[model samples]
Structures are given as C-alpha cells and as structure tokens.
Target chain A: MKKIIQFIVLAFVLLPGVARAQEAAGSINDMWSFPVVYAYDEEVTWFFDLSTTTFAAESDVYLWIWSPSEPDAGNWENSSEFAKLTYEGDMIWSFTLTPTEYFNMTPEDIAASAGFWFRLKDLTGSLQSEVHSMAYTDYSSFAGSGELWRSYPSSPLIDEGVSILFNANLAEGFEDATSIHFHSGLNFWDIAVEYQSWIPEVVEKTQLKNMGGGIYKMDLIPQEYYEAPDGYVMENIAFLFVKDDWAGTTADQVLYAGEFIPPPPPVFTFFPQQISKKDFLGIIRTNNEPGINTLIYTVTAGTVEVTGEITGGVSEIKGFVNLVSALQNVDVTEIHVLVKDNTDRTISDTTIPLKQLD
Target chain B: MRSKIIYGLAIMGLIAVGCNDPDDGSYVDPVTIYEKMDGDWGLMSLNMVDEYAKANAIEPSEQNMGAYFNYEDFKIRFSVDDNMEPTTYEVMGDVPPLFPANGYWKLSSAFQQPNGEAVKIYLYSDAQKTQMTDELKLVAVPGSGEQMELQLVRKSGGIAFVSYSFKLNAVN
Candidate 1:
C-alpha cells in the first residue's frame, strides 16, 4: 500500500501538463538572477552607446559623451565640462582629453545608468546625434604574463585598467522602440572614458630639382598599449565585446563571449602533521590534499620520509633522500620543497629555509 | 599662381620719433627698411630672419645667418622694423617662418625721449630674457650692409640659424 502511493505521486510530478513547482528558496544565486544581457566580442575594451570611441578618419561617426550619470541625458554642449564624469560603475579613467581638459575622477560606488549628461560634438560634419543612453561593456583577462608555483622576480612590474569605446553614429541607430540591449553582465555602468579626435595639419611643398613631393610616415604607440601605471596587478583583464548597434536581438544574439581560463590549482598548505622518532628513522607527513606541497627533513643522525604530489591531479610522488653518516649528530633541520610540472620540469624549488626560532 | 605670404607681424607698441644724436639722425636712411625687406618679398626676405630670430632668441649674423636658407620644402626671410613708427610689413610669397618653439618676437620702432637721448626700441620675444620695453633699443649694427651686424642693445642679439634653438618655451 505504501509503495502504491509513492508511485502515484511520482507519476503526477513528472506529467507534461503539470507545472513544475519552483521552490521559494530564501537565497538566489547572483548569476542566475542578474545576468549579462548583451555583447559583441569583435572589439578591444570599448563597449558603446553615444561615445567618442567611435572616431575614425573615414568613418562617418564623430561625437563624444561626458555624462557621469544619466546615460540618456545626451547633453551635447562644449561649456561647463565639470559635471562630465561617470562614477556609477566601479571604474575610473584619468588622462587629458580634447576640447575638454582632464579626465580625473575617483569612483566610490556602483549604481544604475550614470546620472551624467553628455554633449555630443558633430565630427561627421553631417547630422546631429540624438543618443538616448549607453551601457558599458566588460573585457575579461587581456591575456598577459604570470607564473603559478614560483614567484618570479618582478624585474618589470605589471598593472591594469581598461579603455571603453563607443560609436557616435551619423544618426542614432538604437532607439527605445527598437532599443539595442547588451547582455554582458560584466559590462561597465559608470564610464570615465575620454576619447580623442584627429585634426587637419596644413602642409607646404617646394619643387625639388629631381625629387617629387615626398611622403612622410610616423609611427606612434597607442595609449591603450601602454603598460599599466605603477603599483597594481590586473587579473587577466581583456576585451569583452561591442554593441554599437545591438538591438531587439535575442539574449544569445547580443552576447559577446569571453574565453575563460580554468581556475588555477588550489595551493595546499602543509602543517607538520606527525613525526615519529624511531631508533633509526624520523617519519613525517602533512595533510596531503589538493594543491598541497611537501618537503623532506634532514635527520642529522637518521633517515626521513618526504613526498610531493601534483596539484588537483592524482599523480603522487613519495621518496626519501638518505642522510649520510657525515650528517650524524647534525641537528635534524626542517624540510624544504621543490614543485615540478608534469614533464618533471621544476617550477618552484623554494627552500623554506628554516631556523631555530625558539 | 598669385604669390601669398603669411606674414605674422606681432608688433606691440608705437615708438617716439626724432634722433637726439643729430649726426646719427641725418645718416638714417628710410629706404633701407623697405629695400632690405624685399626679396621677391616673402619667398626669401627680411621677414624670415625676423621670425626665426625672434622665435629662436638669436639675431642674424652677417655671414653665418640671416642669409637665404632652405626649409621644410620652401625658402625663408629676415628683417628689422623701424623704431619711430608702428609698422605692419607685407607678407612673403612662400610659407612664412612660424614662431619657432623656442622663444617669441614682435615688430616695434624708434624713439627719442625729452632728454636728448636717442633710443631705438626693438621687440624682444624671448620669455627667458626680460621683455624689452619701449625704453630699450636695437644696438647699432656692429658693421654695415654685407658686413652689417644686427644686435639688440638690451632687447635682442645673436645669429639666427635653424638649429639655434635655445631658450626653449619656459612653460614646456
């Protein structure tokens, strides 16, 4: 009779017509609730909606935004550039920009759509830009150099920040009626981006006896390529995507995907788990778990046990280095370790150099 | 094509007239100012040296410079405006000398104070040096035409050359 009741309940819960009962749990995963709405991965760090990042010599787009809040204010004026920074998103940009002078601001918190108003300049020499609002785009790790097991000497230091760009179209492309939405949950909200523009230089020419008017080319390093300023380390930051005109598209269609790096192995910390003093041997073992490391002790008078393992892997290495007679009566010092890669390549061999600190 | 000169005459003041030194006054030649400034006027004349000298903080020497020189494709000029009148000179045919990035200069004139002291004022453009006021004058030429040496009494001096970029923009 009890089994019959259970079978009936199971069948009812699995029925296609029956609605699945969602559990009213107290906690909801942040990722599950707040999600990335849209993105375009073909660009560097700039994500857009009415911005100066859209500047190009031949491209018919030239307008910049300086609204720190109110993403839709689209206030395109050239005076009183004070209220021009955005601090809603957890980011900052500091540098000198055009027409306007400095790009300096420190952000203390994050909020929805910046409350700043922007003045749009007509660089296209065409129509005026009537931008409604802009959403920030996030870039993940911009694949740089780093080490795992060994702390490499920081001869040259490292740091990080991002450049966000946008396109100011000859005409506003995305609208509320057909508003383009981005899905990158990691997108920038408050931006401090100060885009640059190009000016025309007048050149003169003289007729050379044998040479024609020659061509001159100059090589310059873009500011974006500059190493981060001193004293900071960026975590694998990189380009996320663009949405210069992503509108009315499905969440998947607007998404700009980022490549994820598998998390590094957890570092296993060792505590001298146990030590047994036998007549001729000193046995020692530490908690041998994921990402854990180990070393061997020097029994000035006896033999000792030592082991090393691959982090997050099943490879186990157990061995012993014989302490010779020359070491007899030698104080049994502490153990040290050397971590190796799968190919037996030694990565870290730090001698946790010990001392008798009574 | 019609010749065009981008003459940049930044003269700041009108100078007083009459030479207190009666001997020097009679010898003063009015035609020389206009004659020396002409070379096809702008393509290669006095304006170039004046512009370059003012910008570079060095006056033109007779042989070493203030001579016809080649530049980013075209030719250049040289000149010294009078101290008695506020004059705006004509432009040359080629590209005029840009105020070099080093110092600055402007055109000015001659003067004689109530005291009988003959004072010839020339504009000084170097920010590193004190701005020569209406009281200072162009030092009399050490020598004359062909060997003519133009030096500033307290206002200007030195040989103008392309690489003579001393007294760079102080703000820089």
Candidate 2:
C-alpha cells in the first residue's frame, strides 16, 4: 500500500533529535481573545488571556505570530499568515482587521500588509474545548527551557568583598548592546548600576496582557565582576536593580519566583565580556556550593591576577588561592578570603579597588 | 450436532465478558469519596483568607486580583440557588456577592492510605457548606501528607484574582 505509506513517512524522517525536539504545544487550556495590532499605530487593542473565548458557537483558535512571515508557500488560507482574529458564539465572531484594515479590504497593493493567524472555530454547543499553540516567539529565554531556579536565603548571608546587589528581572532581553557577565571557575567581571552596565542607559517598551513582552537587562553589580572574600556583604544589595529575570523568571505568572543566590562564597564570575582591556588576565574560580575545606587568598594592585584553582573533583569545591601570588609587592594592597567548606564552614571576604573602578 | 449446540452457547458468552475484577475485594464508602471531592473542588478553587503572611512565611500567601478568566459569558442567574452559602466577597460585578463572596474557604479531602495512594483528591462544592464560622484553613489529604500539594487563598478584596499559579506551562 504505497510501500506501507513510505515506511510510515520514512520512520518519521529517521527519528531522533529527541523526537524532533517535541513541543509545539497543544491544549493551553483555552479562553483567550488576544487582539492588539498597533503595528506602530494602525490602531486596535483587544487582549484577553483572562477570559473571552469560551467559544461555544464554533471553536478553534490561533492568530499567533510575532513578526517574520511567509511560510506555507502556495498561498492557501493566505498561505500561512499570522495576525488573524475571529471567533463565534457569545460574540466577536470577527472584526478588528487592521493590517492596515485587513490589507485595505483586499490585498491593498501588497507590500507586507500585517497578519498573524489562528482560527479554526467549530463548537456551537456541548462545550468541547481543545486548541492551543502560541507563545514561542522564537525561543531564547537564555536559550529555551524552563523552571530550575530554587530559592536559598539561609538567613541573608553572602560574604567576601561585600557589594551584593543582584535582584532579578531582565525581561525579553538582547538589544545589540547586551550585558550580564558573571561566571565562576575562571573569574570574570562586569555588573554596574548607576554606572549602567547591562546597558539600560534607557530603553522602554510596554504592553502587558498582550504577550510579546520585554524589559531588557537591569541591575547587575557583581562588584563589577568578582574579587570578594572579606566579611562578605559587598555594599549591601547595590542599586538600580530592575532586570529581575535572567535566572529565576517571574514577571508575575502569579508571582512565581526563585533563582539568584549564587554569589555567596570566595566569589568569582564568568562569561559576559565583549571588550575590556585596560589590563586583563582574568580567571579566579571559587565554588563553595556547600564545600568548605578551608582555603584562602589575597591580592590588590592595579588588577592583574592569574593561576587560581579549585578544579572541582565531583565539585563540592576544593582548591584555589592565588590572586597572582597575592599581588606581587606593596603596590598591591587589598584582596583577602578564607574558605572552609567540607563542612568546616568558615567564610571571609574583600575587594573594591582595582584602582577604584565600580 | 446442531452447530455444536451454537458453539457451546458462544463460549458461555465469552466467559461472562472476561470476569470483571480490578483488585476485587473493596469496601468503598468514604462518604462517596468525600462527596465527590469537596464537591467538584469547590467549583475549581480560590475563595479566601484575605490576609495572613507571617507565621514565619515560607511561601504562605493570599493576594488574588479579581479572579479573571471565567466569564461564563457573565451570568448571575441566582434568585437563590447557589444555596446561599457565601460569607464575604463583595464586588457586585452587576451584583453577585454576599456571604463568602470572597472572604473564607475550608477544603477537606479525607485520607486513607495502605497503598491505595490518595493525597486529598476529594472534590464537590456546587457552592454550599456549613460548620465554619472563621479560622478557615484546610490543606487536605486528610490534612497535609501524601506528598501534599494543593494551596489556594485570597478573599479580602484583592479584586478577586486575575492570575494565580497552577502553571500549565508558559513555555515548558
């Protein structure tokens, strides 16, 4: 029979890639009426995730697209469009066009006339609901995947060169001038607030119940990227803290919350650094996730440190004590830390002047 | 011989339709599974506590903002058939709040383990119950055990709720 339907579509195109990355979603519960299309002002608002599509006169839903279009090739049903709005029963059966008013009512001389589609509708009675799929705006919440943040406030404690300000929320990120650099193992830097670093020198975009959200990088202050270990409270929660979601995500899905408490030991940072060379030889790794076999270090000059190690044997934290041999000479001044984590649990801190930066 | 006596009466009607037995021996009568689970889980949930945050707060809550997402196309149809059991929730969205309209709630899901595995799944609340004057609290699974999980609170005018957490995935 057609070679058994081409061997079941060639075994689903030869399977594996984790089931083609399973998840285009289905059954998002229902009751949505979204309809906002301002498109820089063609005007039309209408949103409703809180209720309005209990659709019982024909049910099916869609109209999900956040930009990019042209896919279904041979233009059937307007060839895969996005930006549509229609319903049945209990109202809004259809009307709110505005892709410049539905392509000026008949393909108004075609030239990208706004669209975002999702409409199947088919109810009329018995209630039967089930049609969902939207909310994938090209992924990238730090590269797709969710929920893994857990809170950890052991009674407000994180020592070492104190300046500890990392209150979360950096919604819908990335704007060509990106920022958020804090890593471990190989030390790193970059987190300022009044001195603007996660690049929020000013960016504002608002729209709530309409989705496609964003808030852009806010409040980073990892003591401008690592060098802590003296009594560990780093300038108490540094200011300008607004990008509240990079790790724990909660712009209020009923106030979810979690993810932030990492910088609490013989500190260090990693990753984010696109340019910084007045003097850089970075890599100061310290992981005390619950290790405290007691380790210490000291350093301070105009900033140049190398050779530090705690290499992580199954990593509950192990060794690392070189601020480049505690900063060569007398011009070196401040950098001191003392850890002891295999339950010995000691803790110390210090760090603020690489010639007083930020 | 007469078609083997009608195939021996169709193999005794397929052995009485395969003898029906899913763990046989049962005495089910926990008041009909606690009245069909607190009576349909009190019309799905959320109705009170108004405020109570510091008993050493681990995540204790109650701040509903107008429980949106239910417009049964906006209906009131009540001349008096919600059995009049509201104790305090007032907004009158075209008028329909009196008696617990948003003030108190008390859920009770009886437990009974022995490997039957049930952590408070009782449900049934076509909205009407008594025996609670105040002090409202009822975590359920007979009272918190069976890997406990079910929390809902909010009554004193936090609007009513717009979005709380049952999280069916915003982007799993």
What is the DockQ of the complex in model 2? Answer: 0.01
- The prediction achieving the highest TM-score against the true structure is 2
lDDT of 1 by residue, A1-358 (tens): 9999999998987885455332221211111000111122111122223223232223232224545433223443332344233222222222122211222232222223262233333332233334423333331211121211011111111221222222212113322222111122221211211111121120111000111111111111112333333322222222222122332222221111133333444333321121111111112223333333443333222244344342323233333222222232345554445555444544445444222211
Q: Which 10 consecutive residues of model 1 chain A have the lowest summed lDDT? A: A202-211
CA RMSD (A), model 1: 36.8
lDDT of each residue in B118-163, candidate 1, tens digit only? 3343333443335542222222221133222122221123322212
TM-score of each: 0.15, 0.18
Candidate 2 chain A lDDT trough over 10 residues, lowest sum = A270-279
Specify the CAPRI tier of model 2: incorrect
lDDT by residue (A1-358, candidate 2, tens digit) is 9999999988888886335332222232333222211232233333324134344333343343322243323333342334334554444344343444433433332234333434332222122224333221111232222331111221222221111112223333433213332222112122222222245432221101122232221211133333444323332332222222243222321111123354545554311111011112222345544333333333234554432334342233333222222443335433333333334444434443332211
> How many steric overlaps does candidate 2 have?
93
Worst 10 residues of 1 chain B by lDDT: B163-172
Error of 2 at A311 (Å): 2.3
